[model samples]
Target: METCGSMSPYWVKLNASNCFIGIINNVDCPENTTGLESSTVNLQLTAFAFMITQIPFSVVFGLALQDTENTFLLLCGGCSILVFLLFPISGILAFAGCMLILRDYPDLERGWSFDLCLASSILILIEIIITLIVTTVMGIRSSKRKSNGKPEESVEGKGSSKDGDTQTQSNSYGHSIMKFAQVAITNGAEAAKNAIGMK
Candidate 1:
């Protein structure tokens, strides 16, 4: 990276060896190079990994607390709670350490814990998107399957009830037509008689 990058003493100027050394030893720059914080900065990044990875541990601790009959489980859960409380202090330390590392360095990386944090964040986002897609698909299918699901008999299905409805409608229509024809015929006869001056 240092070879590829322009020749200045920034993060991008780091070589591959420096990455391994800086990340492992928690140093911000190469051994000879005076970049950022002291050597212990890398160790502090362990906090980042824990921060991203401890969700399941929190659940486990909660479950452990529920085990009333098991003394060992209770002890473990209590310790876990203690650790959880301590996590913030640890984060503060890591933040301070990271700030020290970042104080001079312009870019991220050369930090091992950052990798874990980034990876976990991306994984969570992907999981959420997939979950939402599946849920939406299922919901749509369920609603379509559930809504307006009357039996075939309700909508001109081949059942006695459907047949009855159709028959009733046709019969009423026929009756109306017959009555109208009768009225028309009676009016025509009356008009013809009147034209000839009959009562």
Candidate 2:
């Protein structure tokens, strides 16, 4: 979470500098500007963070479409944590490492930033897919459990202090799955928020 706090100011500085530099470069450029000059900051890219903006929204989508079972929800949570780690690293690298990359190709910083975002996007896409499959399987298993005379209630029932009959009656198959799913999502969201410094 400290990473997020530290990176926020850098992000602001990077953007402000990029904008200020860009305006100065454009205004200073001679009238017929056919190509980017050496002084031009073409490598500036807050664009790479474009995909990053989709993350919180994507998690919401995942929660809506993903399986709410313990395993799958865990998967989603794990994915979110991974993103939490990678998000800051990639952003900081893209923003702060610009000078290092400038030694190579001109405007290479933008390319590097784009590449980082692309890699992160690929990982996130895989996470979303796995979550979808796991969720579907969970839904199917839940349906099967419901149709059977004895539902999958042992674990949930054991946790409760209620009497045998009351526990059995209260924890219906659908209810159990929904409850666990809600819990899993909530925990995962909390973890992600904490990691992102959203909380």
Candidate 3:
């Protein structure tokens, strides 16, 4: 029998003399092997970590900014984080139960194990679908706002013009009117001086 870690749900035993290693999957293995076959495992692990670490940070940051435009998005992101957390947690528990059941009985089919592996895969697909729909809707709304001639100005003080020449002409007309007023004033002052000198 192998010593069990407090975090692990199951005990692990290795019989090196007989080249046998058995993991009694009672505890959750939050860390997965880093290899091609276990890529989903790694992804789920990373997502779980993000749920625990990044989600709260993101929520706090969003609250600090206090942006009404991003309120819905922040909430959705928070829900996604919750889903990520719950899915893996439930999966780990289910996997642990299944392992314990299989350990007691020696005649489990390979197909059942395959099904267990696919659970995480299905959850990942669901996450992807949800993200796609949310992002697509946001993108469409943004495009619509841009097309309505109310394009949001960038932080760097750059703006898009619906008609460049129209803006330029408007600016030019204001400048011309100011110049004409100044010239008129100067001419009137000169005429007054000439009249006084002649008098």
- Summarize candidate 1's per-residue lDDT along 1-199 as a digit string, tens digits: 2111111233323555544233333235545754335443453545555554467668778778778787857677767776665455444545455455555555544443443333444454465568679999999999977665755435545577777889999999999999999999999999999988964
TM per candidate: 0.34, 0.26, 0.30
RMSD of 1: 13.1
**Ten-residue stretch with the least lDDT total in model 1:** 1-10
Query: Residues 1-199, candidate 2, lDDT per residue (tens digit)?
Result: 2223222211111222332112112223345533222331232333234335447946754784567556756656666655555544444434433443344335322423334434444555566668779999999999887767344465566646367667677778769899999999999999998989963
Clashing pairs in 3: 8-27, 9-26, 9-27, 10-26, 10-27
Q: What's the lDDT for residue 29 in model 3?
A: 25
Error of 3 at 180 (Å): 12
TM-score of 2: 0.26
Best by TM-score: 1
* Residue ranges of candidate 3 with Cα displaced over 4 Å: 1-109, 151-199
Q: What are the lDDT figures for the candidates, one per model?
A: 0.55, 0.47, 0.47
Which 10 residues in a row give candidate 2 its minimum summed lDDT?
A: 5-14
Write candidate 3's Cα lDDT for 1-199 as tens digits: 0012112322232222222112223222233422111333343344334435545665665664576688766766566555555544544533443344346434523222334333544455566678779999999999998866543454222533435667999899999999999999999999999999999
Candidate 3 — worst ten consecutive residues by lDDT sum? 1-10
Off by more than 4 A, model 1: 1-12, 15-21, 25-36, 39-63, 66-70, 106-199
Candidates in order: C-alpha RMSD to true structure = 13.1, 28.7, 12.5
Ranking by lDDT: 1, 3, 2
